[model samples]
Target: MLATMPAAPSDINVLILDDNQFDRVRIRRMFESLEFGFHLSEVENLDGLDQNLDNKDFDIVLIDYNLPQGDGLEALERIQKHERNCNATTVMIAGDDQSQIAVRALKSGCQDYIAKGTLSTHRLRSLVLSVIDAAQASPTNTDDLHERLELLVSRVKEHHSSALQPKVAMIIQDIRSLRARVYQPHSPLAVELAAVEKRCLNLWSSLSETDAITLKAPKDVRVS
Candidate 1:
């Protein structure tokens, strides 16, 4: 059975990178046959892919592992370098049934991988929907989990006053615990965990704003 697409507005944007014109068209046709709506931009080279990615963001990016420059994995690496493209679902297309390629791609940050030779509309739909669903559920998918969290922690230290270091440390703890329960969302524990994380974020924001106000305040000047 074909997977049902989520309740999304009009056609979702998609970017496909393949040096082969035939493969690009084949993939586009598969998407066309699906019940789900999609607006696709096809690129035949890394330069084209970079150009499209630079100008706009896509809902998903499909990468073919064979290219004149490097490969699909290389393309994925380049995409990872751009923070705006971080949320876009990325999938690797392999020419043959190579499990190794799929394993490596997944570890390196792709949402999923598929063998192009055996690609069908059903498989494509299912794979695409599954990754999209997972991404929607896991906010951690914004970027590498540890990397994103570290960036936030650094910001907290920068704008926040030194006196609140203890509270900041506690918030950091809550964030770590939040990470553990992040994927296992659903229970009351998860609900509370999310709340705790929200509070932590708000605390940081409020602290930064307070500090800014203090710095901008004028001191009372008395005539000596």
Candidate 2:
């Protein structure tokens, strides 16, 4: 009997960074043939990668180990630093037989490494699925905090829209007062805001840790 296969989920966005046209074409074809879903975009080099990243959000990044200016490792480091909530698992692809490079990539936060010559459609599908699973399993607290802040801002805007003339005048006055107070270096309100921001970040970190632990427990139980 044929082995059962898992159902394909909705298409996840993927960014492929490779300078070689042949490799990019081949990788795209392989992904197209897979049962796994993917909305793919290709970049020829680091510049292209940067532009694509600025405009789009990808679920996974497949970076070539060798590039024109700098290698994949450098690109990975830059991406991690610049992209907020960049939890996308990076996979380093190489044609060379350099085990050390693979190890280094893994150390630098790559989810997996695949030799270019050995890449197959099935293996690619499996790797993508694993990365997506890991991302879903690990939720970042910074993202949650940013989301809450956005919601608060939206509510404030809504209140501003529905306010009467007197309320609007009062709100405008309050804003001007707050701005003036913030300009003073020794202002108590500024100190208070700083403390609140720090506390919120700490709370976010604590919540992230707690959520990670909660997620891992169930996985551990299933594995055991």
Candidate 3:
């Protein structure tokens, strides 16, 4: 039983994959109270999840541990294959306290996790801001940044699409080294990136709010 949530004003795009109607409703209600404008799309099973990820990239992806049709961890593992969606910040939501699942998710690359019972409007909002901040923050080292840049360049060259924005396919096709851009203030993708960031900041003024054994952050990034 797969379904897509109706569209909303999109300050950020989020894709949520979970099978339970009640839990999905709860998650949606949390977003409704937030000031930020977000477009959310939900899918109940693995096929739906893969179909959505294949066509569009989400800024954040939240995955529930139990699914009617498949394991959330297994789905997370497969998401790595999506070159663009692979970089989306991911978080895991579990129905119960499961340290092993949490650890495994972290090791696999998820940025954060929380028990479903513990979720609250305030907590959800805080986590959203923090993770988005972390995603925008520059890498801790040059090599890490360089590696990302090279990866982006190569991926875009092969696919003729940007991992950052599906719409801005060739945005960074001719990107200069990030090392130079660090001192320069703007890169080729500056305009688009700035717009995305400015929206995040504005959403903060308004207020608001996945996984991947499949997608991992760089080694130096330690989520608090």
Candidate 4:
């Protein structure tokens, strides 16, 4: 039996931070053309960004890599500091050749990054829909993380002898790094990511003791 695809959101509230008027117009036009309804509010500087960020319950925030009054990364950090807005999916917009900046933004916790030169209605629609779906599916409370962790740990135990274990190990390491790199240490998302990191570490430690998968545990920490 085929699984059903989730329905598109009927309405989406979007916050955009970009000082360039032309880019704002382009983004507006692209968003307006989408079949699903979206309400976009543009912020050209830090003051506007700070004001609307607190007042609006946005589903997504599109941040530009370049800003006149302050750095875009700084703006992103400010957004993370707001606990009420933590659920919003952030996407960074960068110049076509600004790959380094884009990588930094992604590592800093933006859900995704898009090149300004490649902006189009089709691409924008796809990215917005995907982010919205992920945001909608994400856990709204801490308890959900435990349920998810248990499921992941079960998967690890089941695949203990398979080649897929190594790939899963790599994913665990990435989650650990993500948890460490998060800006809002006390935010629900950060706490959840930390829980995942701890569980994966525990799984790897147990596997190491049993000599499973030829995977060597990190040497610095003693496995419990």
Candidate 5:
């Protein structure tokens, strides 16, 4: 099941490295929804990552910019030093605050940067398809994909400011509204959207919750 791809002649093998189990699960779910015969391998630490790269023949690698072991740059460096995986296509999954880091990776030979918050099922599939298509069409030319990914990086950099928190709040509200509409009463989309909405709501609740330490401080205590 992991090595067979019936949709295309050349099966795509993907390796994902992230420290968060929730993120790993989310990415796996998104990939499973693509309905393509792709093999996926995941690792949570640098050791596992190095071991996988050494043992498996992967076509692409998706690395989280911030990991417990080290950052995505360290992962990229390892990939570069690997004798067999040196030329493997790599993408960085970055937070909104990390556009500059992503840009640095892109300049250092990463294929693309995907903002963590923007990774929905549709976006994930589109990105994978674009990368795979580009890789196959002209293994040397990535101009189109590079231009588009640069645009995404620019957008992230543009939004990296004090206003980002409010913007995120607005986006979550929009998602909630959209989910409510799609999840009317009892439908499959509704069921799925309900789960999505719950996740968003939980995140919102966390954001809105007052800090426990703050609550216990003296009246004169300043949060700043």
Candidate 6:
């Protein structure tokens, strides 16, 4: 019997890198079919990958070992460097079931490795959970800072439309003060949270100002 796995983390975001159009589509479909709660993003080339990394944050990265410009190892190296301050987990996806390549990927900082043809939703879910657990358990100073910012954002949203104008004003002041500290080079966690703040603000701005608020209990949201 196959081993059972826990549910996927609903808050985690995933980034997929694959040059082959067919493979990219198939992998995306698999993630979608699982019905797991994951935010999926994709890139077909190194340039695209860089741009995506700069614009949005991800919880995990799934990179195909054999990309166009260089092998997966090179890409992984670049990712590690670019994401040095990030806590995202990196997993190398390979077309060939090569033990040597898997070993090398691990040595090069990949959290895990999977063969594309044998990939399954259950396995993916498990890997993602493990990565998240690890990150939370031993977060860097930067990670802690981001967590604090997230809590602040959540609290602000909870009272965002309330009649308590003073509370909302205080929250806004707190956010602005935190934003100043976030730009310091020594504050990796603050910097990461700053980026997240910008993204969230952009998304919020895109939505209409008048909208009914509904509190729905969290449910498993997955993608294939």
On lDDT, the candidate that comes out on top is 4
lDDT of each: 0.75, 0.70, 0.67, 0.78, 0.74, 0.69
Off by over 4 Å in 2: 1-9, 135-224
Candidate 5 lDDT tens digits, 1-224? 23333344477788999989999899998889777867999999899998998898888899998888678999998998899898788889989877798779989888888898788877766666776777667635579779878778666544542334354456556655776577365778767766775665564444334332122222322122
Q: By TM-score, how accurate is candidate 2?
A: 0.57
| lDDT of each residue in 48-76, candidate 1, tens digit only | 98899888878789999988888888899
Q: Tell me, what's the RMSD of every candidate?
A: 15.3, 16.9, 22.2, 15.6, 23.4, 18.4
What is the TM-score of candidate 1?
0.57
Least lDDT summed over 10 consecutive residues: which range in candidate 3? 205-214
Best by TM-score: 4
For residues 15-102, write the lDDT of model 4, one tens digit per residue.
Answer: 9899999989989988877756788999999899889988988888989988887777988898888877876778889999999988
TM for every model, in the order presented, reads: 0.57, 0.57, 0.56, 0.59, 0.56, 0.56
lDDT of 3 by residue, 132-156 (tens): 5665574658899899997785554
Q: Give the clashing residue pairs of candidate 3, or none.
A: 62-210, 90-210, 91-210
Question: Which candidate, 2 or 4, would have the higher lDDT against the true structure?
Answer: 4
Candidate 3 structure, TM-score to reference: 0.56
Q: Any runs in candidate 6 off by more than 4 Å, and if so which?
A: 1-10, 83-85, 139-224
Off by over 4 Å in 1: 1-6, 131-224
Find the 10 residues in a row with the least total lDDT in model 6: 215-224
- The parts of candidate 5 lying over 4 Å away from their true place are 1-6, 138-224
